[model samples]
Target: MSKKPAGETLYVILGLLFIAVIGLRTISTPELWTHLAQGQHNAPISFLASDSAVNTTWLYDKLAYLMWSIGKAPLLILLNIVGLVGAFVLLLRVSEKWGGALSQGFALLIAGHLMFQMIDVGPEVCMMLFIALFLYLLTTQKSPAVLFGALIPLQILWTNLHGSFLFGPILAGLVAAQAAQQAKPSGGRKKNQTNLSGTLGLLAIALLVATLINPSFIKLHGQVIAGIQSPAPVYHSSLFIEYFQIPALKPLILFTMILGAGGLITLKKRLPLTLTAIAVFGAFLVWTSPYHAMLFAILSLPFIVLSLTAISEYIHSSLEQMLGGKAKLVPGIMGGVLVLLFIASIIPAATGCAY
Candidate 1:
């Protein structure tokens, strides 16, 4: 493998630092105590006279408990840092693959800011890591051994880790559909496309099956679905602002609208269908509860980068046509605006005002 350029390495390190600057902090979530308490039961499934309390996050709780045993809350905080940083790194690497440095950096910073509040000792943090890993596998890995070996096991662990294990099969299915939609039977490429589509389809099915490996088996699905569909009373209370409905003109919502516009403007070039699907799914999550804003943030991140790239290229080309020599100035100004936006979004957290 060829060595990465020194500049690229420095860029990556800076990106990691940006994520950590926003992500690193002391754990303050009350849910951590509940998770640790439940973890002490030593059972993934519990039978009760009234209802079976299927522990969807049994593995996470167990691991959290193990960390707590070793070094108490400090170790759990370390695990949270490692998991969140790892997830952001995977996302940044994937974003770099498909977009310019400016777009990817902006996307990562926005995502980190949105996810910052979620940085705590909980299953949701673990879910963030798994989501990034699954996205990495879907986008970058094509080898059968790696895809199946990694994805199937990932689903199993994810099922036992969090209720969002359903995302594995959902994302895989979308990828398979995207492949099938793009495939055309013609020459040597036809066989390759067919195999790729078929492999991804099988992978989706395998991932779905893997979710049943948890102690609750098929019943786990019902439990998780019900949990998601059930509205928590906290959503309606005033204790947290995350559950509040986002204003239409909020900066993040406007950014999302811009991404949608970018996708529409670049329709001829064709954005990935899977991205559009995931973005829509993310919006649905936010609609259900603003507490899931991080879901929208991370899920829409790759698509946001791609949309920004397409929009940037279109603007550059259009500007070059109108003002051949001065086109670069416009994009440079836009880049500066993005940096300002990032700084503004993170200022509250960075200065400890958010805490």
Candidate 2:
């Protein structure tokens, strides 16, 4: 195996920090007690029976039942730890493939925010791990057929695990739409247009069919529709929490959103299709549900890093011309110092004194 780079080291450090904070919160809080109560009320058989038994996803309850059956808290804790670590690794791999070290670091920071919510013994944690894996495969794989084929089973599992599974197909449809829009007309023959249209059509059909593979089928779909219509009370009751809003005042959320916006403004000249798809998806997630605030933050890192690199290149070229030589390293050093200070401040806040 090749040696890890400095950037990868930084990501690992940050990832460990995230795990530690989440683990501490998971062990110390009353969140697990609530989940246990919910689990007892739902029961394991409800997953295979009917949606009338529980308000939450069947898959999550099943997993909790299995853990509880072990007759030990240690086993449940172990499984949760494993899932959390899996999510971190998947996030690192996806970010590394999309952007290099700096982007990976940003992804880890965003993952830290997610870990806070995920520690509460909820279905969203499992859904996030699967979502990360899906993104990793989508970004790194070359064959659309292979990727979508593999994604079918994952979608079924996701449907059982969390209601947020609906986002998977929605995301794929958005990507297909982006691809279709970006396709150019080939010399009046419309060859490119035809091919793009066909691909998008196939993707749409596959996504639709994938949802049917779940055991609940239409019931699952109906539950999702109902949830959307009714809205969760947590969002209404906890408006003061950062997780309940777009985090317009929070430094990290504001920074990530600005980065995503900047990417769309500047990098559209180069990676127009990718940046446009990201912008649309990120904006939709932020606008539609407060629960998805961390998803937007996690997904925006790659685009932000790409945009910053382009801006840095432009600046370096302009300075080289004006100076007739190399410029000083003051800016880079200052930027690094600022980043360190930001991390220092954020990490402590994440890992509270109770932890």
Candidate 3:
């Protein structure tokens, strides 16, 4: 096999460096203290606090405490950075089949900027990492046994780590529907495709069951329901900010949306139904609260990049014809501009400006 392109490797390294710079910011979320305190207790549920009926993020708390005890806030910051970077890597892999590294890198930078705004030295970091990993496994795994087998344990762990674990079953169900839809067009392997879809559906159910393996058992889901109906008072402050606070970075968000739409309209082929479903789900979350903009951004990054890649290809083709041999310089200049934009995006956070 021929060696991979040097520019791809450079793009990856540069992307990672940008991520590190963004992740290096000060830990500002006050919830980190509450989580650290909870981790010191043996009981999974917080008996004294009225904020939560069940400790949905007990495992994350425990892990956070461990990291804090070792190196204090610095260690926790490192963990947050790791989660952010790991999520980006998985996003890179997921989008690789649809686009080139340059496009993937650019898309992820947009998503990461949005996602990292909400992340701190708390369970949110773990939630982001788990979400990315879960999406990767669901979309790529071919074998039903392997897919379900992996997701069940992951769900169990995620349920203990964060309340957003409900997304696991939701995603499974969506992917299962997509699989079933694909089966209709598959001629000879229709039966196999149907089986895969059926397995995914079952996996969705299994994930729901696995969620009960936590400390609160069935009561945990009740808490989820209650929280949905009326969010806990602890979230009131965040809820207010997320719902009403106009983000200064809204321009970037709008830019990504325009780019994604432009790409979708210009696409040469139909976008996959699974991606559409996921993106819709993500949009719904953001609609519920701006705090979830990251969720929408990250979940839709692959789709966005797919569009960007198509647009880039179209542009590159035009340039190739116009400039011929001199067209090679364009990618380098684009790469430099990408780096500059990444730096500019983080300037607000770096200088203590609020979102």
Candidate 4:
């Protein structure tokens, strides 16, 4: 492991309490309370299949119950904060792996908007840590066996932990596809891509199998699909306003688009096909299901961070050239602009996710 930089640590500590900043603007509803109450003496799997009146899977219900057993109900909230903070910490680490300092803008954006929300004690925050870790591995881990092995436990655990476990294999397939494309031979391209393609294929299939190990087995897939396809009222009237329908050109979404454009224009290095494909898919998910914008954003964060960092460097270099090599001024100017953007991003965050 490498030493973590001080700048990146801002979110790690503050993020633990980020959700608390908004005070009473919480997403916790009646259902979460019921689930935790039942989980006190019931098995975790019992809660998975028996939606009963809750009509929702309880991901961390048992955790909450066990915490309460030890006189630690408050500890449940702390874990949520820990996972949220860890997600950013892992993200910063991954972005730094690609190239140090590329994560600055994205990290700041997260701290400004994502950190302070009412996402209290849900499995989704825990889910973020896993997704972030997977992405971190995606960026730095090259060994096929290692990735495959890692996903087996992760998918199994995720499937039981949350309904969004499918994201694990889906992301894995996209990355593997990217790897295969990159590994293509100079000649007879199709033939050369086989080694990685085969490995990735096995990994994907294995991950799918891993999902089956969950309590719901194959039925879990159908349940998740049905949940997605069903026209739920949660999209519009849920307690969590973030789940509400997104307007055309919402401020955050619009800013994300502009940031992406600037990144493409300024990025000095070539964009990987894998990242390009993931970004497209991420955009589609966020557009279609605004409920999971936070999840999609976190998953695609590495690519976003990389792009922004490239833009920053490009501007600095351009300014240096324009100023006849007085590069020192460039840092001060960009740094000030970064501070301004950070301040500007908080404006919408105060209102929380505009569901």
Candidate 5:
């Protein structure tokens, strides 16, 4: 077996730091306490019986109740920590598969930003984990049925956890559409595309059904849609954070968007359709919700790393031709310096600097 390199070790360390930042926020925030109190206060049988109409995502509520009953603070903290770690691990695996040390480091940094967004308590964290899993399955598995079947439960859980359940189908459908369009001209390609699309459609429908499995039934869906359509209070508030904007023009946001665009432009021919699909879907999500900006970062990181690698290789080859191999160290040093600058710019100097 090959040994892990020093750069990979640095990536792991950065990933851990990311988790630590998120964990600190998770443990310190008063929001979890309110959520816990709400869950525990409504744990009575009579409460459920009387107020079923108001209870959306009763399954998630039940889980929160369980956590509160066990050891409120510890349980909630553990859940967030585990979920954050799981997200990082999945991202690392995906990036390692797609690129290498550079991809892994980029994935770690992007996932860190995601954790920093404080998605630990809500269904968004679970959705992110499932999304990571879905990406893994789609990339590694050859059989579309197997991947689709596996995703059904994730979809169900997503529906129960957050209104973002729709994102799963939207994401999966986009990828399926891309796959279908990119299918080969052979008869087998058509069959595969049809099956893939059908499976994704079925899973989406099953998820919708699962949403109805709760007591609120259709009301839950109505509430979710209403929530999405409703304007966020933050949009009107004095806080002008870039993530809350409909179309963020922040420097970091523009940089990531440019990086994603550059990746597509540079490696459109070399990348797999599935990878492109993930990038495009993530980009769309970022366009739709500033909350998904970190997701865009995560999805684009591997592509950018791969693109940079390709560019580095190209530059090295070109320089070799120009200088007869005497200038190899120049490209290597330049790449290393650029990577360092990238890392420095992204990393917060202090906790107060995070904002």
Candidate 6:
């Protein structure tokens, strides 16, 4: 690996530290308890195992079984903790591709918000990781054809791990759509950008096909949609606060509120198409139910942060222009409030103060 760059290295270390603190701060047994005990009488392949086994996500079950067997703890805290670090790294890198340099203020806001989300380690934890990772892979791909191929393995694995795998291709298709728009058709020889964008639609199709390779097959796709579209809540009432139902308030909702404000204010300007779509998808999930708010928060971060940063600059510059240097003292006073909120919100996690 290449030597670590200076500025990014520290933030990465801090990110890992934040995850570690959160992971260790709260320890809960995930639902691997019964699965491990029940599977002892059967083979590992879940297909011939149990007709009543709702946990067809055998890939994760096996991993969970391994960890639970050895450690006897229904916890993948370390794994999920590391996965959180990787997810953010992948997210920011991909988001940076569209948003330019992320401001430190926005970075803190994102990190602090996620500390709460990371405290619970379960199937959704890895789901979040692969969601970010899938987008990152698609974004980083140099060739369009290879991009589709790369998603196959991930999509297959993701399908076996969590029901949220359905969104992988949807998100990828959205990104591909944006790429197609960016790559306006032209006969010019130097139209690499256009060529790359054109292939994303194809990639989306391939990803769709790859998702079928999972053991659950086509039923998984239909089943997930049915669950999501079910009139009654798919997640039970006694689960986490996020899974309660519609009209629930989660911490991530606060970020989306900011994101909505920033997105609307900046609508007249030339923002990214893909970013806007991602934000829209996030908002839809939030509106549909609170359970998907985590996905929205992850998707909307760069957009919200970048927009707020721009807004801050606009406000400061406008004030300076209007007041003719008389407004120079405003930031010093206001900056303190922002800083205090930052520390209150984010610093404790970094320092391992759990509460």
Give each model's whole-structure lDDT.
Answer: 0.74, 0.59, 0.76, 0.62, 0.59, 0.63
Candidate 3 residue lDDT tens string, 180-297: 8778664777898798889889999999889989887988788778777875442335556757665455566667667877787777876777676677677666655666765787
Please write out the lDDT profile of model 2 over residues 1-355, one tens digit for every residue.
Answer: 4777664566556645556455543444455555665567754434465534334465576567668877557667667667766766765665553455544555555546643543455565676677667666655554667766777778777877777777667656655665566666657436665565566557656766777766666877787888778765434344455654433324555565666666556553556454446546765765565456555644554565565555555565778778754455634553465358447745675656422
Q: Give the poorly placed runs of model 3, Cα more than 4 Å off.
A: 1-3, 42-52, 184-186, 231-247, 317-332, 343-355
What TM-score against the true fold does each predicted structure earn?
0.86, 0.73, 0.85, 0.77, 0.74, 0.76
lDDT tens digits, residue span 40-157, model 1:
8764344654655677788888888888999987777777778877887787666665576677766776676666544555777777788889888898888989999888877888
In model 6, which runs have C-alpha deviations exceeding 4 angstroms? 1-16, 29-56, 72-75, 98-119, 185-191, 231-255, 267-269, 322-342, 346-355
RMSD of each: 3.5, 5.3, 4.0, 5.3, 5.2, 5.2
Question: Which one wins on TM-score?
Answer: 1
| 10 residues in a row with least lDDT, candidate 3 | 231-240
- lDDT: the better of candidates 1 and 2: 1
State the TM-score for model 1: 0.86
The all-Cα superposition gives candidate 3 an RMSD in Å to the true structure of 4.0
lDDT of 6 by residue, 1-355 (tens): 3664554454444544544455553454445444454345434434564544344456776776687667755355667667766776777777664343324335545544644643465666777788788778876776655675667888888888887887787877777666666664556633766566667766778778887887767877776777666733535545565554333355456655665576568544666776677777777776677656566656766666566656666676889889987878765554455456555655665565534
lDDT at position 197, candidate 2: 51
Q: Pick the candidate with the highest lDDT.
A: 3
lDDT of 4 by residue, 1-355 (tens): 6665665444333332333342223435665566576576454334456553222344466666777667655666556656776776787677664444425554445533532332445666767788877777766776887887787888787787777777777767877777676764566766656666677777878888888885556777887888778734524355655665444434665566566677778776767766666666766766665555666566666667776677767766777778876876665565456556554544444555432
Candidate with the larger TM-score of 1 and 2: 1
In Å, residue 169's CA in model 6 sits off its true spot by 1.7
